[model samples]
Target: MRSLAPQREETAMHDHRTLGRELDLFDTDPLIGSGLPYWLPDGATVRHTLEEYVRDVERRAGYHHVYSPVLGKRELYEISGHWTHYSDDMFPPMDVGSDQVVLRPSLCPHHALIFRARPRSHRDLPLRIAELGGMYRSELSGVLGGLTRVRSIHLNDAHVFCTPDQVADEATAALDLIRRAHTAMGITPVRHRLSLPAPGGKYVDDPDLWRRSTALLTEVLDRSGLPYETAEGEAAFYGPKIDVQIADRAGRQTTLSTVQVDLHQPQRFDLHHIGPDGARHRPVMIHRSIIGSVERAVAHLIEQHGGAFPAWLAPTQIAVLPVTPDQHDHARALVRRCADLGLRAHLSDARRGTLGARIRQARLVPYQAVLGAREVGDDHLALRLRDGRRLDPAPADQVLAHVKDLVGAHRTDLW
Candidate 1:
């Protein structure tokens, strides 16, 4: 459970909302209503980079990426226990052709259907299905301010349909992936929390199910070798979860990644897989998110890096600035070569001002290829990094190759 600290100015220097505006990452318009921010070109670049990176990671981890409709029939949520237990946070159902349909608040129901779409064998155990898709929440206008709390959320959601025996390993692997992702994005979680069901909350009325789920999550956490707190009443309605908590600029903690053990959804959806004994056996449902909501993740990242993202995630990886119009031809060649390496390198216009001014303009860019008359004659580039480190002049091709290598490897080092 995250303790919400009232939005304060303590450490407001890195507030995502402020940086978001300054960086032109995203914005909200009244015509679009509250809690919905549109991504600018730069923001979209950051988002697309993140989405591709997540897909690549999941592909290597045996996860089958999927796309499901954002709207599902009302009956789907009814059977998934969402209609009965979570309608307060859901949009009202709309009547369409004598059938009620609504925006989906979660992707689990759809993934469950995909799992049940075909009969499976024990060999297919731990079938990982992932989606980075949009879902809606009916949040109060008062609590809606920035990207952190939004109505239209694109979640990095996944489900593993595995046998009970495979639960521990799948959950553990999910945690490792989360850590790897955070490290690459320069994010640090505040702590790990084992979230339990609230005693008198709107949960499925199955005490035995809750107890068993809690014990399983407890055991899994115990094996993690990481210290964590047991948060009462923070578990999802369907099961207990392990939450990776992160703090905002105000020191307010929130969940950024999660892994939950769910048996209730399987029972509700009647999900199963065939076993070696030739019997139909129930499959455990493991829900995990490396970066829960893309919006929230980006918001946290904007604050975490103060709009100066790592090379891989930055909108402009390298900004090529020619010291004067005399060096324009050389700078143009450098820009083209960097683009050939598939980098987002920009050539600064001489009209922008002096070399010092252009360098200051691109201060947030991870790499700056500043070419001067001397470097142009020598066929080398003067490289400046965002961290205030300037490397010795090197051949243009050598510097471009090094930048490409760092971006491909998702490294923040300015070697």
Candidate 2:
């Protein structure tokens, strides 16, 4: 329980997993391994929105996205030191007949190899490579919870290869990206922790390298003026890192983003770039993630908003409901119009029940378009919001404009 925002004295009436079931978001089945979850249509919609958002952010930050195999050779981890230091958390290696491989627990090693695949110059310094990398870990069943703790994970991971001089700037840029991403999603990182290696610890045993990396990170954080706490013996085995802690509405702070500075991996992988003086120099590596994983971020969001996602991120932004079977044609027409306008809209057939019942059920959708005789005849939409606010009927173009504004602004409120 790190210092976080104040929690409401009133308890949350519904947990995320329960809301997830009600909303048809995601579920876990014993048939499918213990910690794995199946993302239903609604859940996949949210996950896709998250993935698209991170990819766009990374792209704007000059990151090159790549896709790699989920499984890697066991020797790859041996070179990266995960074999010695992190094997306990990794799944057992699979025997592929003359070759042994394991589902990658992280994307750092693979990105290191990508950086080393070609000859690079000092001009190529600050190469930022990113991916929505899928990873697997062997956590004990007892510790597994819904989406928060699972065997499979899809990480918004990136690695920056830069010269020693560029470490501070690169790290600061990564911090900016993290801040922008969280702000876009209406999440606030309560504080940052500078995780450092403990003395005589299991971390990479190079004291000089540790001192250099830690000092560089401190300088960057100081320059940025972001207050942070230093935690002893909390550094990753490879290097020091900055962990961004986000507090949910319940006042529980979780580390959902990280910016780590690593100097050893380049040496381990023999990565090099030609410097200004025409000499080969090893590059420093920065590992970062804006959103650690799709599952955890969405889980936190589900609970934070209580299943009422923002207009732009909602699975169904607008629900179209007709008054009777005769009005179905009008409802269907409006659904098509909304789709053409780039809105996620679905038709909730009025044959199901009364307007009150449909409105109640459409609470899951951000906006409900009630198409009765007058609305259909006038080519207007009767909009009802999840917050129980009803809007006057507006022409099709007017409604489209409002929804576009919400989507463009990524607004959480109904207009």
Q: Pick the TM-score winner.
A: 1
Worst 10 residues of 2 by lDDT: 3-12
Q: Summarize candidate 2's per-residue lDDT along 148-207 as a digit string, tens digits.
A: 888999999999999888989999998998888777676777899999988777788888
Candidate 1 lDDT over 88-125, as tens digits, reads 99999999999999999999999999999999999998
Candidate 1's clash total is 0
Q: Model 2: which residue pairs collide? A: none
What does the lDDT read for residue 56 in candidate 2?
83
Task: Give the range of the ten consecutive residues with the poorest summed lDDT in model 1.
Answer: 2-11
Candidate 2, which segments miss by more than 4 Å at Cα? 1-12, 248-250
